[model samples]
Target: MPDSTPRAPVLQMPQVVVDMKLPQIRELATQLRFAPEEGRIWMDERRMVLVHSDTFADLREELLASLGYEMTRGLLTRIYFAAGQRDAASVLKRLGPGASLKEVLNTGGRMHALQGYLLPEHVGRGLAAGDLRSDDYYGEALWKDSLEDEAHVARHGVGQHAVCWNAVGYCSGYLSYCAQRTIVVREVECRASGGNHCKIVAQPAAQWDNVEEDLRFLLPQPVGRRARIVAPVADGGPTTALAQSAVTDSRDDDRAAPRSLAETAFVGASTAFSVLRHKIDRVAPTQATVLLLGESGVGKSLIARQVHRRSQRAQAQLIEVNCAAIPEALVESELFGVERGAFSGASQARAGRFEAAHGGTLFLDEVATLSPTTQGKLLRVLQSGALERLGSNQTRVTDVRVIAATNEDLKQAVRQGRFREDLYFRLNVFPVVVPPLRERRDDIPLLVQALLQRFAPLHGRGHVGITSRALQALIHHDWPGNIRELENVIERAVIMLHEGEMLDLQHLSYADDTLSTPSYFGLDDTGQLMINTDYDFGASQSPASTSAASPAALDMNRLADDLLRQGPGQLAAMERALVRSAVRQAGGNITRAAALLGLSRAQTEYRYRKQQSAPG
Candidate 1:
């Protein structure tokens, strides 16, 4: 029995305008500037580090020549797939959320050409008038301009359909994000296969006739943890192919987060995560049923989709069934199709989740909550890939790879006689355990960076990162709710900040509410902003009451009185506060912080030293 969830509303695209010409490639390339400044590289407001083409090309050649076609292609696909997602997000952000479909498609395609990937030629008429590219004008990719194709041909002879696997994955990922649906692209013609140039077509998943076969190439293959440069062959045989060797820092290509993570709010990389990641890689390409064991908020559904992406069903939809969310009475009719007049309210024959997920993956989240009767029906479908409509005896054959996830221990349920033992064993052919966030602490930094990148663009409050001290505070806490909890915290922090203020976390609330412990960013002695977590703050402790009991409140009043008496900071008090706050926010670093205040390091140090000497 499959759980039923309401489907997402399909997005309607804009009606196409005649002869639409987007921003030319030349103008877009001009905006793509590379310059290093302020101890970091800058591409406009975004922080970026520069890389030369030869350096990248050299690495690409080595990876392909040494790792063989399968290993290299899978590795590169994952890397660029992530890059495509981030690029699409940035493009959409720049274009504004409400831009018309034609604007997004035309500009996105032009950006692809400008980025030196493939030259996308307009296919059919123009932008299709829906969430999907219509049959009239599906997207097309021309191969003559692909940098990757040229690089491959220069070293390895053209031998196959299309050697540009990375670009195909990249285009597919970018367009999919734009369409708000899963779109797959594949090479139909290629220069590598002795054609004049490489050419490919893109379509929404429903439009693909042979999606099951195409899904295999999209699976996340296990890539090397690191890569090293094998010096180019002195014999001039284009001997730069990457062979496995000592580990190097070549894996920093993580854009946003790894695309293999799939539609998740967060991702992490740590030894604790390796077990599940390895299991996903090994089982994704196979037909074996997988049971994901994890705690709530551990991202089980996203991991399930990742397995689908890497399996033979990438071209099909990943239908999710939230068992606990569905009504108990409707479970039967929802899992199997319902015929017209099957029940009092059955108006027409309708397909269920099983029918919808034909030739794809069906993810049953929280499968442990399933009732005993539903469990038996699910077992029947698992044993024989055939099912019947609720009111009809006619049977239908379906091909779906089932992946079930649960936060509960199914073994305990079976022993308690609440769950069937046979069904449990059938679903447990391959089990992958997902570790909680507390166990994978090493991945916090990467997760934070990735989360900030996503949240910053939406709220415009993450131009600068939090202080290391704040980061330490985040890492030290044990996350009971896991990644979902972390996401909420980051969002709250973003909302609290104003534009142009760097994120300097001063307070943290492990609990859902921080009402009693209101966050106040105060500076401490030694010119450093200190995080005062233990302070009690609320309406009860408001300033009106504090005048009677708090020395700090008394001091502030006295300073105000002094300012009023002597007239507007006659004591030079506010200036001192500003200096101290600057130093504190800089994490007690003197010189760098002094610069933030537009003062020379030596001058500020000299004035502070003189003040100390003159003190009584």
Candidate 2:
């Protein structure tokens, strides 16, 4: 049964305030840089491109004809939404500490106007004055001469429905980023819809009456089945909303109550993350087993959780197991339950992960490490949904969806006979590759903000901020260890900072200036990666004297004389001393010390051991 009664609109526009009167907004024009010599325009570190209104209108018409109206709107909305998120990250980084929430939100509006999208004027009480998480909180704005609506109406006749989809999406994205929650913005009145001016309303997504209907244009079409919004009963715990299907549904009251901000939300707005998100949305509804392939510490566990959260089984248990952490002999007992007296230490019957995860999901990380015997049992359970307990002939049945993840190549393992081919196919029903952090450098700023916000509160450090130079260094680094490495670096930097102190290059472990590969790469105003060529490599020379005049500053003749003054065995002693010094400087890490000394880890260890055993 649907609620057929009509409800009043959530917002009504009040007297509009002039944009110039707003005192909270930062001047965005200063951040805008132009370099005609290099033929580039930049807004902070982001590259900006200029597209004519007619050209955009042409593309919109083509997309509307080809993919249809709803999809075109959704596609354009998502693009601007990502743009808004990137802008939020830039503002957060540049604002430093002690910035009010009002200032941030106002700056976002000003930024939208600066980009030639719309001249936004705040109507009704502004968003910053109220608590964003409150149920009654609502925001309204008037867009004077919206570029989207003006171009849309010029290309095609005035439409019945509001046509400013990009403006709605950009507002939603910008507000959501600043709030750290999902905010939905709708163009209630548009010039294309015969309105004198465009009027937009915004509120948290969960507060909307028909959230599913509002979000339909943003996601891809589902393969099968109508969309359903499942709102779990929360016992003082977290809750998530089910995203609507790609196609629209005519049903009423398809509502979900999504929580404010959660730590589990996907934080990155980069294209790589967007593609990965689309793949997850497509596969989450199905009961097919998902194989998450990625390098270690690439957030596979988080992806597994995301899949479960978005699936029909969100309310059920999600059992996670690190296959590599468990010993080979105990792997079977852990995955499948053991009956009483099943083994020497078996005292009582117990349910395995599959039983625990009945009507839910089972995330098996490092799944390639399972032995042949265990792999065979896993195959049987996956195929027939039945398993036999250890030391027992009785069979048990459990309904569970499995999502397996691994850094190793399963196909290569199958070819080498390390993993079963049958089991591999069973789990590989939907493979999603999570890209490494280095491939998505645009996400670093957002990730940094999220990490800092999460870490600062835990350590009781109020308002810990980072320098722009330090953040730039982070964006340039090659994160071989992926997100995990980034987390370690940020956490270490946070720990080094004093209470209320800002994080600088000195606090970063990897950003030390003395290192050979210093964190000196930065993006110029033209958005080009520029190396800090001005860094002085000549350290041993006197500060007041030039290297040309001080030829003996690093003279090998003096070193040879010193060696000659010592005994014949001085060379070996010097070599041992250098290895020891490198190891000490590397904080006892033999691998890093080996890198410092330009030797293999084994070679470094051998030399270190020989020197240690030979007398002081």
Best by lDDT: 2
C-alpha RMSD of each candidate structure in angstroms: 22.3, 18.2
lDDT of 1 by residue, 1-24 (tens): 111233221111111222223223
lDDT per residue as tens, model 2, 186-227: 888888888877888888877888877767764343221112
Q: Which ten residues in a row have the lowest lDDT in candidate 2?
A: 244-253
Error of 2 at 391 (Å): 0.9
Q: Tell me the spans in candidate 2 whose CA falls farther than 4 Å from its real position.
A: 1-45, 49-93, 96-265, 510-616
Q: Candidate 2 — number of clashing residue pairs? A: 0
- Model 2 superposed RMSD (Cα): 18.2
Return the top candidate by TM-score. 2
Scored against the true structure, residue 585 in model 1 reaches a CA lDDT of 84
